[model samples]
Target chain A: MLTFKVKRRIIYLGIFCFTLFLCFFYVIKTLNQSLLYFKTPSEIFDDQNLDLSKEIRLGGMVKKNSIKVNKREIQFIITDLKKEILVSYKGTVPNLFLEEKGVIAEGKLKDKKFFIANRVLAKHDENYKPPSENQLDKK
Target chain B: MMRNLFSLNKIYIFSEKTLTFIKSVFPVLLILGLTFALVLSPPDYLQGDVVRIMYVHVPSAWIALGTFSTLTVLSIINFIFKIKILEIVNLCIAPIGLLFTCLAIITGSIWAEPTWGTWWAWDARLTSMIVLMFFYVMIIYSQKHIKPKNRSLMFTSIISIIGAINIPIIKYSVEWWNTLHQPASIKITGETSIHSSMLMPLMLMLLILLLYSALIFLMKYKTEIIKVKRSGVKRL
Candidate 1:
């Protein structure tokens, strides 16, 4: 027979384990239910059930040579390689927003082909490198 | 073996020696880390000098996550084995964890304005970090205001265990969801994308911060021990 202290310890351990399992279950369930922070251009195009009227964030790389500056308004095409959506915004873009750079635009989708963004955020990759000589010269 | 190693008398003696050692080494490390971080580290190709904020931001976030994980484990052991020392340790750690979490969030916000064009967003990563902060606050609050020492310990353990669930979510949030926050650059298992020049400074800063944390923990632990002794608490 186990001592009282050992028994109590075992009981506490059992309770901790049970609580941990419950927490894990809750986290998994919640994470599974629409926790997406942003939708890519391809995801928006493929999903027929996506509500276009509700404002959502569209994230992808800005297509090369697709940026057009018409006065204060900026137009660019965001592409996930498989699909692309035209994004139009009338404000200042972040310094990092450049051709082929990752970006997230928060707005309502006008249609499958166009997104009207109120805010455009530059999303950089994890990679970090020193500027090359030519790029440093340009700076 | 573990019990003997963690006994109050042994820990008290150990803390004294560790404190002296840390005090001496801390200044040297601080100078070295600052020089490497601010001067030696190369500017980023894209973000330029603004990327230097990462030296502080990443380390703070890492320590915040690490402290909470440590607290949760200690709380579990304390709850199961009824170790009084672990309770003291958990109590001291909670505030430090909260401070670092706040530091991480602030530094990240400062960094975000220049890079992401927004001060804040309800992204998965950012939201989960905020939740972690709330957990720390809850633990600290309960520890202070809860009546009956045993009940306080129980509440802290339970809250910490529940909060532990958020840890994994914070780490994987970038991958599991498309967040404005970038994915991890430094990985334990895989190849790191950060170049060695930047990586060196980052590591130096992390080491300095970790040393600072150790120094603070030892000082706090010593004070708690003294307080318990003065109160004539026989549990220790």
Candidate 2:
């Protein structure tokens, strides 16, 4: 009876080990799938054969005076100091998307140096804005 | 045999002064913290009024993680030393931790809708936080439903040890993998990405929420002890 009880406990321990191993493996595999959410200009610049069919996000700072508002299309350059990629979007940009500020555009690569953006996100700094003119009157 | 692990009339009880201190101080702190977080603080330049959600959302995440860490430590000791008090502590902390985890997920969902253009994402940090919450639910369920008190406690302690590994994964998920969730603004290197004006109220809200959780834990602990004592006596 004692030997039988010991054998059962060992089996339980083995099962526990197998389950833990499988859970960790599953998490890591899923994590690898999510690795393409964003890429910097330097990363894309280093890659020789970039995927144009798959949509990707290009994140960097907007170069000063690089923003040009055309009738339907808006064009700007995103730079990471080492390299620059021009992003063109056909949609309205966020309010915080200012020149020389941080921004991330979601779209596909047009070429090695140009990106066609589906959406433009303006990354805001951490500071809070004080109440504006109309908001001050209520106080 | 395991059903009688805790006998009647031997549970720890808090002193009157301690109860009074928690009762009187926590409400004042809560009101002051809420007023500052909701009204006095300035809105974000980009996020505007929606940024106010951070006061509640961020602190809940912090407290949830903190509670889980405490549970992990207590469970480890319980596993090694088999201390009875530590088992009770583990049971008491689980529900409070679950409450905070739920609050963090719900408030985060609300905040994300305005800021991220979507209510949910498979972001690494978000997914791992949800996993932590599931662990909390598992702990609570096993404790409540598992038969034979000693076996249930042992199972819970082991489960907690297994779940402790996920806490670090949740903390560093943003850095390890590229995701939509932003990287942590506050760093242990003494540099904060946020300005002082916004930091002050946020810190206050976090402090009050911690105090509130502590108070709830103490009250729940007392009630759990009382329940055990009553049940044990009735079986006698």
Candidate 3:
């Protein structure tokens, strides 16, 4: 039969375990933040504390003639209203990885000031896709 | 007798049980706390009102790693102790962990598009999260197809433990390579670390997220237990 001492030990032990998991969980929760989560090419280079494991989003135009593809890796340039940034990828190119298209690459930013993309999503012109030749008449 | 062997009331009688409860409730409370920080806590001088999103975005990212850490530690513990609860906990944690990881990626992107002038960057954290997302998918996929009774828990626990490699990958993601995001905050030790004002909200949000995680863990654990209990019964 289980004695009171045994049961008490179990209770105390459970509480101790709970506290420990909470503490470790808290450490990750509280401390893992950054001054910034996104970066333009200029900002990527400007900030000195950049890291590799962190997740980031890089946005810009797919510079014409700048894109280079080999196997799964693709490299291109992104530009804002002001400056240009270089980006590299080593995965299936998102369908919209075309020149002059607005693209957002999801991947890592390197210390080299270049971004290594893993996925890409293209932006369509806000003007909206033209209706199929017949859809215009459906209205 | 077996039901009474480790009953609900008996949960208080086991250290593992207590750990389970705390693990379950932590995430929910953390999420609520994040909401508070976002609405009530101080805002960033530069980002203003919108800055509040950072509180949620950052901690969600934080917990994504932490949740996976649970998988890692519990999996290791599972290997060492062969406890049933650890496997249950790991299964329950995966869905929420993946959700938070996805949330972090999405929210971070929204924040970046404006502030950084781009929608995405191949930063250290960003890449790892994508990896984290893949891990989450594989874990969930494995859990679904694997035999429920055939040492799957042990195998999954091992998977969870091994998956822990991502945490370090995430932690050092910024350090090992060059990316656009900054380094650790509460855990960092550099001369130019996060300011207290930022830290205050971050802390509050983190507490909320911790609570939130526990809440999530418990909710899922309870449901899983119920599923287990029903597994053997046939209803006519």
lDDT of 1: 0.90
RMSD in angstroms, all models? 2.9, 6.2, 15.1
lDDT accuracy of residue B183 in candidate 1:
94
Best by DockQ: 1
- For model 2, the superposed segments whose C-alpha errors exceed 4 Å read A1-33, A122-139, B1-12, B15-17, B234-236
Residue by residue across B1-236, what tens digits does model 1's lDDT show?
A: 97788778898998999999989998998999999888888899989999999999999999999999999899877765677788889988888899999999999999999999999988889999999999999999999999998888888888998888899989998987788999999998999989888999999999999988888889999999999887786664
| Highest TM-score model number | 1
Provide the lowest-lDDT 10-residue window in model 2 chain A.
Answer: A125-134
Which segments of model 3 are wrong by more than 4 Å? A1-139, B1-9, B12-42, B188-192, B231-236
CA lDDT of A126 in candidate 2?
39
Candidate 1 lDDT by residue in tens digits, A18-113: 977887878677776467778988888779897888999899999999999998799999999999999999999999999999999999999999
Candidate 2 per-residue lDDT over residues B178-222, each given as its tens digit: 666777777778678665667888899998888777777778778
Model 1 spans > 4 angstroms off: A1-12, A15-33, A133-139, B1-4, B233-236
Candidate 3 lDDT tens digits, B68-177: 88777776655554567667777888898999999999998887654444577655678778988988888887787877754666566545654665678688766554
lDDT (Cα atoms) of all candidates against the true structure: 0.90, 0.79, 0.66
- lDDT of residue A34 for candidate 3: 43
Q: Distance from true position, residue B198, model 3, in Å? A: 2.9
The deviation in Å at residue B37 for candidate 3 is: 3.4
